[model samples]
Target: MSSSDHPNISGSSQPLLHQKGKEIQEFGTVNQVPLGLSYDARLYACQRLNRVLADTRMLYSLYKKHHWLMRGATFYQLHLLLDKHADEQLALVDVLAERVQALGGVAVGDPRHVAELTSIPRPPDGVEEVPAMLSRLLSAHEAILIDARDAAARVAALGDDGTNDLLVSQVVRTGETQVWFLAEHLVDTPLVRL
Candidate 1:
């Protein structure tokens, strides 16, 4: 067929029209799932996951701040370590957010939203000493670990196996490891004399 014979197919190559759809789901609500869990279970899981997500996001921010503000004899080491932990926490943030969404809940995206959701205490705006910074990081990690452990147990009891697995395998494990590393930095052991 000649180009003119296919007028419908060659209609100036314009893009297809689109329209914005109305919001179908609210932030605090969940859609039905066939995972065999009760509505109460999914709702509870999402609430717990959202809390973890908030704290994880805050922890990631602390890591970045400490990474930039690092200063001491171990500056290079701590700087690199904090950046690495930040990246790890960032990964956990994504996992937690996705888990919340999979449970049909909206993940908090804004920093202000996270601040409102998170229970982690806000740190000073300016730079803190190296020990103080490391201590702060450890404290954040512990807070997350404690919550994840409790949530995992409760979610598992509620028959939300997926959330339980995520809390135990990813969130708790990562937080515990990071806590160990940060806590070691605060040890008073002498490098050479002791």
Candidate 2:
């Protein structure tokens, strides 16, 4: 019945549960690739992927925030759409992080780290009007698309075909499609009239 009698309690004889390890690699650095690509190419691809990863993470967060805060006559539709977009963005986040690791670079996993790397403007912490929220999402999508297009082109020039393909096929395509969907919601066309 005493505190000292508890088996899991930490004491002079009990040790902590976790072990610490030395840092193996630093962020923003990549090791040489044996997969027929030069060190410079892998390094460049990793750098580009990390940037995309950071922005995708921020976009995903925005989607989730808007999903929960969705309102008005379009609440049901917008809620589902935001959640779907968030899921897609989450998938891209995984792909991007894996691509970074494949290149022997550390992915920016920490949100604080991501915030520092992301170019997407931060939204208001509190909820805004649905139009403002949708606009915010549209802007974030455009920012990612612009960066992805440029990065894809540059990586292709660097002979990083895999990274280039992913940026174009996944990141760029997904962002463009999402932008289209979000933009349509902002059109002033009346649902019941012209």
Candidate 3:
């Protein structure tokens, strides 16, 4: 058919794949985008966020263990630091889980799911040294921060702004803050503490 003879597509000629955000309703009223993200995008964010939560939980336990059991000349400071990190990681886990649920996917619960899904490498059992424990946690947190930023950017590109914003805010605020705290132990250049 000739271009002019072909029927003009109505409504959003923007194509479903590229279209996003709220639009006008049939009655000419604005409506929210109704959590109706593409399946692949939703699943991708779900798995990514779920993995992060699992890894953070593991790191939380590690920090708590170190906080209570660590011994050194700087024991008081290190103990407080570890405890503080545990709380931060715990809050991050909650945030991630909520995002997963918001995407309409079942979060992988249970320890088995975490063991399977977590991308962060596990520290060896019975690591009793302070420096050793801190090193492992710092490494894990770094990886998580990287992944969170990447995943958030990807989701935003796919037009899932809610998940994207959730991850972006966490990545910028939480991960950066944790990095400052962890860096102090290793930097040794009179850096100001968090």
| Stronger candidate by lDDT (2 vs 3) | 2
User: What's the CA error at residue 118 for candidate 1, in Å?
Assistant: 0.4
Summarize candidate 2's per-residue lDDT along 89-190 as a digit string, tens digits: 999999999999998889999999999999999999998999999999998998899999999999899888889999999999999899989999999997
lDDT for 52 (candidate 3)? 72
**lDDT measured at residue 106 in model 2 versus the true structure, 0 to 100:** 91
Model 1: per-residue lDDT, tens digit, 13-53?
54445757897877678888777989899999998889989
Pick by TM-score: 1 or 3, better one: 1
What ordering of candidates by TM-score runs from best to worst?
2, 1, 3
Q: What TM-score would you give candidate 3 relative to the actual structure?
A: 0.74
The window of 10 residues in a row where model 2 has the poorest summed lDDT is 7-16
Output the better candidate (1/2) by TM-score. 2
Q: lDDT of candidate 2 vs native?
A: 0.92
Model 1: weakest 10-residue lDDT segment is: 7-16
Estimate candidate 1's alpha-carbon lDDT, on a 0 to 1 scale.
0.89
